[model samples]
Target: MECTGEQFCSIIMDNMVEECVMVSILEPMGVVTKKVKGTFEQIGSPQQYSLCDHHQKSLVYCHRTMELKAVTIQGGNNRRARFNLSRYSNASTTTTNQALPVVLGIDQWNLSCSKQTDSATPVLQLERCKDQLTTIGAQEKTVRFLFYKNTTGFSLTTFESAMYPGWFISTSLEPSQPIQMCQKQDARKLINFMVKH
Candidate 1:
């Protein structure tokens, strides 16, 4: 998982680009008017994290997707090595939607999913975004996923696709298979992972 998007985040020298504090005024109609103001994001940084399988096998980028491999210190610049972990937040709009959904970033590509692939099944995808988000709440919807944290006080985590709910990010029991999106009801498949900082 080589990090290719060097321009992913511009190193900011001032607080101006990192955050903006201001006032807001709005009037929907002559009968209703209101004023509101607070802080807003102009750009957000992707915080780093590392992901591994339940067996602690590091995920490596391969064939435009992910596969299992031994954790390596030389994770980046190797092309197929696991590298460049980041938390790419999902857009927060509708109140009913999960708050701040997450899209895990492997290298620069997002850990995305599609309802159907050439095999006509849900699968994981490494999608490169054409338009980088300039705000915190703006996200690529197709890449969004919901995080399921372990309740027993472990750093373990699992991800389920936001677009197609109940489909989780999973890998085959057999080694070397590309990661796939498995149904929640599926009795087989490895979905839980160890997410580390």
Candidate 2:
């Protein structure tokens, strides 16, 4: 049940989702290749064993079919203060939209296609601000999802490094109900499930 940081990072980098049971994960980047049968003359050469042009087309087709499912969760603590002064009769009135403003966050997230050579499962931990009741006033609020090795409990800096140029957010739900960190497979499944029900 426990895994080291190195082992965990390898799994995440490799895009292996089924190793972890609690969470259902999917990688859109997992490309499937097919062998093309043809003579050296018909094809190009035996030395080139990579997927044929047709095979590459098919792989791309398959990858596009299993991309991430679209999910939108909206909830943010934002407060606005307004003041109005009237010149006549010294009467002034102010109005405020006290409701918690919701923003469309995490429209889509895809899984990595790379495979993991190691056998460790990756766990994602979300960190949020401590002051939940108070509005996030004037300061930028950030949510961080940390991928850690379950056994060693060490952070995978390499995995973090690989995630550059991509956007992610932290979830406030329990580990089992981590809607924020839904993997590609689970996201698709959940979307389908929601549609059916």
Q: What is the number of backbone collisions in each predicted candidate, taken in the order shown?
A: 1, 7
Cα deviation at 189, candidate 1, in Å, is: 0.5
Q: Given candidate 1, what's the lDDT at residue 190?
A: 65
After TM-score superposition, what is the CA distance of residue 42 in candidate 2 from its true location, in Å? 50
Model 2 clash tally?
Answer: 7
Considering every candidate listed, which one attains the maximal lDDT? 1
Write down the lDDT of every candidate, Cα atoms only: 0.48, 0.21
Clashes of 1: 1
TM-score of each: 0.55, 0.16
Clashing pairs in 1: 1-81
Could you tell me the TM-score of candidate 1? 0.55
Put down candidate 1 lDDT per residue, 105-180, tens digits, no spaces: 6555666666554565665666676645333332444334322222112554566655555666776666656677
lDDT of 2 by residue, 108-169 (tens): 22222112347232323212224321212211221121111011112111111012112121
Residue 57's lDDT within candidate 1 is: 59
